[model samples]
Target: MKNKFSEESIDFIKDHINDDPAEIMLQSRKFPELPMRDIVVQIASRQKAKNKLPEWFGNYELILPPKQNLEQASSEITAKFKARFVEGDSLVDLTGGTGVDTCYLSRKMGSTVYVEPSEELCAVSKHNFEVLGANIEVQNSTAEEILNHNLVQSDWIFIDPSRRDNAENRVYALEDCVPNVIVLEERLLNSAKNVLIKASPMLDIKKTLQQFSSCYKVQIVAVDNEVRELLLYLRKDNDEEADIEAWNISDKREEELFSFKYSYEESCGFDIEEPQKYLYEPNAALMKAGAYKLIASKFGIQKLHPNTHLYTSDELIESFPGKKLVIKEVLSPAKKEIKKRVKNGTANVIVRNFPMGANEIKKKIGLKDGGEEFMIFCETEAVGLRAIWCERV
Candidate 1:
């Protein structure tokens, strides 16, 4: 909320508004209390144009910036929350963002009080609740503010903090954070008997369980084989261990494989190789969770290279968590090798973790936009390979 930004920085942001308008929009909406000029400068400093917002920003069109990672809040997190809380009980959401979590709790909880710091989001949440016809009350204040206001009584208090870049922020163990277990035990825990905490998946699950054993359930969620959300569910005075389990969800297609499509399971096992000319990389959530080898081995797909998570096979596989490819031809780096293939000049290009981006690849390959055919260029642990998509095979 400070005004450390300068006028020069403000002008720079305005100049790029036509191209980087999304950045100005996202930050401005998230921190609405700040002046427009100051917000532009802050966005410039934080992002520095190194990364533009995701093209798939449509998901957040009606929601606010989440303190927790929004992209990670797939069904994995939603399902877990529903399973933990019963209906007709009061729960306090300490850090509500976009109010999506609250939306899921709609059918289960009797009443919910959201504690948020962003004034911008408070107004938005009101609109969302009205639109969805929800009766939950939201307080546009921080957890500390609400606590100071003597508003800490609840059956369950939930927390989903921000820790994408800052590890220290995620270090709130048993005794830290808003109304820690110790504080809860003295006050609300006896009355309400529930406290749910969400932390980053990067945290040590064993350590978290050992320190917070009083709570009965500790849930770790991984969407599409990638760890997205870590949930700790507690009931007052309850003592037990959560049955640790793992699951993968795919909205597109689901399938199982017995062996590697090319390399036998007994032959390659879980080993990875270098990048190949033609490679297939899974979707984002999968990549983030480091389930690269698991997917490859599970689907009987071989990696083009170990360094790259891209997969390759002679036949197409259904039900994998990525695009099915029909690799037509492998192009050599030599312009001459590509010249003959370029004669047709009609196909889409699929680039998987390639040095050159999708546009760069398309430009270099002389392919037109929205073509029926596709070419895959990718690297892996062992080597790089190239191929054309035959079909979803």
Candidate 2:
């Protein structure tokens, strides 16, 4: 770890804890004896941690990693979500950068080991883990070195490969990532009974499954309707059709979860109909999972069009894993007709399976953004195109 902060520097940081980091740097000339750079980094990291890692933000003694490492670290919410999959006496984190995941995953296991290639990060993590009272062993080594040397064995192994290449350019493919999970798949499966690999949210799920034959499950996780991470679970000797699950974690409402098999979605059938009393839109997680046909089949709802993902029904399905809106009136896509129904001249506009974009339709219809009202533009099988006026249920 870097040298301990002097007593004078600590006092300065406490006095200006809430000050802007840029402003502090501007006034650094006043404190010639204090470590302004370190103090500013701590204050700035604390600001980011207020929401990302509330528990760590509350602890003053714990040291935060550098900005880049913190950016790559998983938030407390996602780390806790990963902890639910821990089901063994021993766990090993092969690419423990900031140790956010290692700290949480260690809570469920009797023995845990954290391995990292960067000595600086390993030192910071070892210090922080000690301060947090987490019972984890820190190993300053790469995943390949650990595996080749047979240094440790665990029932479960969790790895989140670095997404950036040597040039600091982001890469999403399984083979392009650091340590290349594809090349180490056989060794990983042999090392542990179950292996959990965290991949980029932008990764193509179908393509990734084709790369790993042992993978039996894929999880697409979203927070408050925004997709965040894609997780792949592999078993030692299983090769069944992978089960895909979409999980949306939200603070406003309960979690929305939908799971399906690839074969089932391909064979499922859905009904196409015109607008009804209520309309439903799938969340980001479900959309990323491609649960279009199975969602309608499972919920007993009708699709607006074969290509459109929006659904409708005569009655509200309170349990639907998406937004539920009540259709007030269906207006023609004419400016005059829209003006008649939307007197307020402002609405939350959404477009799907339509030729025009949201901004284009908004400008053409002369409407501003934001309001309790929603305007849904789409192409339906029954009608060529229409604007749906709705209110949140």
Query: lDDT tens digits, residues 290-348, model 1?
Result: 45566776777776665666676655565666556655555554445655665676556
78 Cα displacement, candidate 2 (Å): 0.8
lDDT of 2 at 194: 90
Residue pairs with colliding backbones in model 2 are none
- For candidate 1, the C-alpha RMSD (Å) to the true structure equals 10.2
Q: Cα RMSD to native, each candidate?
A: 10.2, 1.7
Tens digit per residue, CA lDDT, model 2, 103-163: 9999999989999988888888888898889999999999999888877678999999999
TM-score of candidate 1 versus the correct structure, residues matched by position: 0.51
CA displacement after TM-score superposition, residue 189 of candidate 1 (Å): 9.7
